[model samples]
Target: MIALDIAIKNKYYANSTAVVLKDIQFSVKPGEFVAIIGPSGSGKTTLLNMLSGLEDATAQKLLGNSKSLHDCKEYQLGYVFQQPRLMPWLTVNENIQLVLPTAQERKIKTLLAQVGLADKGDYYPKQLSGGMQRRVAIARAFAVNPELILLDEPFNSLDAPTAAKLRLLLVNLCKSCGSTVVFVTHDLSEAIYLADRIIFMSNSPSSIIHQVNVNLPKPRKESGSTELAWQSQLMAQYPQILSGSVSTD
Candidate 1:
């Protein structure tokens, strides 16, 4: 299980202070998929950084499997950022190998195939399309068999078709790996399709305003009536979710 109770403060300028996040609290069950949805500047990425122990915060307490995040040295974590962040000089295969040097060549090749890039292993980041690069990042994230995976709008840049394909790929990988996933996205429909639970935050100086259980069966179909219905319900119930305005004070 993963649990967090944290607050974050930022000094965006010399004279002013901004509380990017306040009184944030949530938990994720083992092998569960959770999605965080909020406005553009609501500090969602900052929350991810705190979970990954990459940022310092004033009142941060993160727990994983009953151990403090700082003390849980045995848990393996993986991250897929908005951008692929691949090494331009290395081939696709080399980029994944860089992280998992002990992994066999055949296993690496198998991963490439899983992401529909089996034939592109020898290509560099520049040679592949944007979506393909993102796939490489996804494959790399799973190559290490991490216990917790964090994703921050990894498909935001892709077109609808590409994004849908990647989402399916992600779900398959998550099912196979059984890793706890915390995904942050602005797309509510996407959230409904992929997450077991959706956490909605208010505007900057954000706090969790609502949490919705998807309760949708797995292997969700893309763009079906069921998904559309849930999306409509969410939008009607929480219209401020996508474009939020909340008083920080």
Candidate 2:
């Protein structure tokens, strides 16, 4: 059975005549790492928002685990957005506690330690650096042992070294949690390094245009040759895949 099955018929703003997404359909197997890449306006974030219940367009619908998201109440989902969105007033530990039905001290501590923020739990959001705050965000998401994790450009703005480190940590966390992942990013190399399968979307009124299975060996590094090779090969072979208007086939 699939962990997620997205089939959005159409999506557009309430007052707008333009369509943002259409005929977008795909299914992700349990524990699979899938990344979605597309141009700037391809509705990638919109899709995530809908799935997370952040937005509900009258004309747009999404199915998760073969059932509507509204009805999938028994399952757990975690989301890490483009920003950490931490509560400045709350300490890191408290922020993580917000998601749990009951405060879990041991689980919270383990998550922080896993993200290299064990010592910062008592610190407020403002006390930590940008990267540290993001780490806390990740820890918070994993605290509940989510069945699915949705990440929207979570590592986009960090320095290269930090982003690379977090990427590895995220992979490890996914494995330990056995959670299905759906990551959205514009970085081609990032997708290559992290995803088992990469799904490409078209521009506005986006749809799944192409998909690449990344069968590279694991323990992947950001600067690893296998990832670079795939990047170079894909760029040369399908120059317009990122444009979302052309077919690599």
TM-score of each: 0.91, 0.95
lDDT of 1 by residue, 1-249 (tens): 344333343413224575777778788888889999998988899888778877664345677876777676777888999899999999999999998848579988999999999999999999999999999999999998888999999999799999999999999999888898999999888898999999888887888888889987877887779888888886776555676632332
Most accurate candidate by TM-score? 2
Worst 10 residues of 2 by lDDT: 57-66
In candidate 2, position 4 carries an lDDT of 78
How much does candidate 1 score in TM-score? 0.91
Per-residue CA lDDT of model 2 for 89-190, tens digit only, reads 999999999989996899899899999988888999999999998999999888878888899999988999999899999989987898888999999889
Clashing pairs in 2: none
- TM match of model 2 to true structure: 0.95
lDDT of 2: 0.87
Model 2 misplaced regions, further than 4 Å: 57-61, 247-249
